[model samples]
Target: MRLNIHTLIHPTIQKLAYEIIYQKSHKKLQNTDNEKTLGMLIFYEILRKWLKIDNIYIKKVDVLKERRLSNQLDKYLIITNIIECYNILADVQRILPEPYLKHIDFNNINNSFYCNEKLQEYRIIIFEKFLKNYGIIEIINYLQKNNQINLNHVKIICLTCNSNILKYLANKYPQLNIYTIKIN
Candidate 1:
């Protein structure tokens, strides 16, 4: 399975996830079991709220079963949940068509600025498209920098909190090399 945290979240769920943790701890970024729990909860909430998927829960996933059996010794087991969720989403698409719904592939490029000289020209245009795709109007309440996205600013980079954005943009614009600095 692709070990990515991007496609696993949407902006609304992200706010809810953070709020779930914020109520428990003041420091938000502390990487602990609580943080992991919040992540799991967000995945569940996405299925429950966003997709109207109630019958399936995170506990039902086999990889999660393995993780629970092993007591989560390997943090990588978290990846299993995201993959399972994506599969669920794909199943939904096959069942009902949602307008403008972007099929997410976690492995796709999010937003990256390749310094390689050979890719410079292509990068310039792609970088611009990336900026537009993720500009303030798009992800303003999410990752858009302080209510303003300056494409003319030159130093354009995306540190995506969720990989779904990358997958959506890539699917929409296959020609442009979507770029992002992966956190993990």
Candidate 2:
């Protein structure tokens, strides 16, 4: 089944929310020196539009009653979405680069180093979502089904934090030797 973009957008927003709030620490007014707020506002607006949430104006009194109240609300709405987006992006980031075991021509594996041009411009949100949901096994399966690789000879190197995923891969593809490295 095709992935829903709206489901993807929420997580992307959440990821950005963490980046903006925790990583950047916009608690102090000085942190707002750059266009960080503006960037966040734009992202919020995009998410609002995608989720079909109506825009509501916040009056000066409302803004004064709680400093950064708007930012806080945006953070809450986007956090879940950001987590989802990060997962997808991480997957794309993991596989899009050259020398993906399944994508490489095994005979020329030592020399081949090409990126998939078609996915080069994936939006950050979509890419993050892919990482969260699609693991090496799924990628290998996709390649095998698409005739990009022979499943019989495929070896999987999985660096995953999820033990359940490792167990699932072990059970599903016994023919393919799987080595997993623990990720914190």
Listed in order, each prediction's TM-score against the native is 0.21, 0.26
Evaluate all candidate structures by whole-model CA lDDT and list the values in order: 0.30, 0.32
- Candidate 1 clashes between residue pairs 3 or more apart in a chain or in different chains: 6-162, 6-163, 6-164, 7-163, 7-164, 111-179, 111-180, 112-179, 112-180
Q: Write the per-residue lDDT of candidate 2 for residues 1-184, one digit (tens) a residue.
A: 2211122234544454444445333454323322243234333443343222334555685463323212221111111123323332223212222212113322233333233432222211111111123344444454445445434343332222244544555566544543222222
Local accuracy of candidate 1 as per-residue lDDT tens digits, 1-184: 2222223345654454455335434744433444444334433443332233223325654554322122121111011123323322233323222312222223343432112222211211111211223332232122224323232211222223335554554454333222232322
Residue 171, candidate 1: alpha-carbon lDDT? 54
Best by lDDT: 2
RMSD of 2: 18.9
**Model 1 score (lDDT):** 0.30
Tell me the spans in candidate 1 whose CA falls farther than 4 Å from its real position: 1-29, 49-184
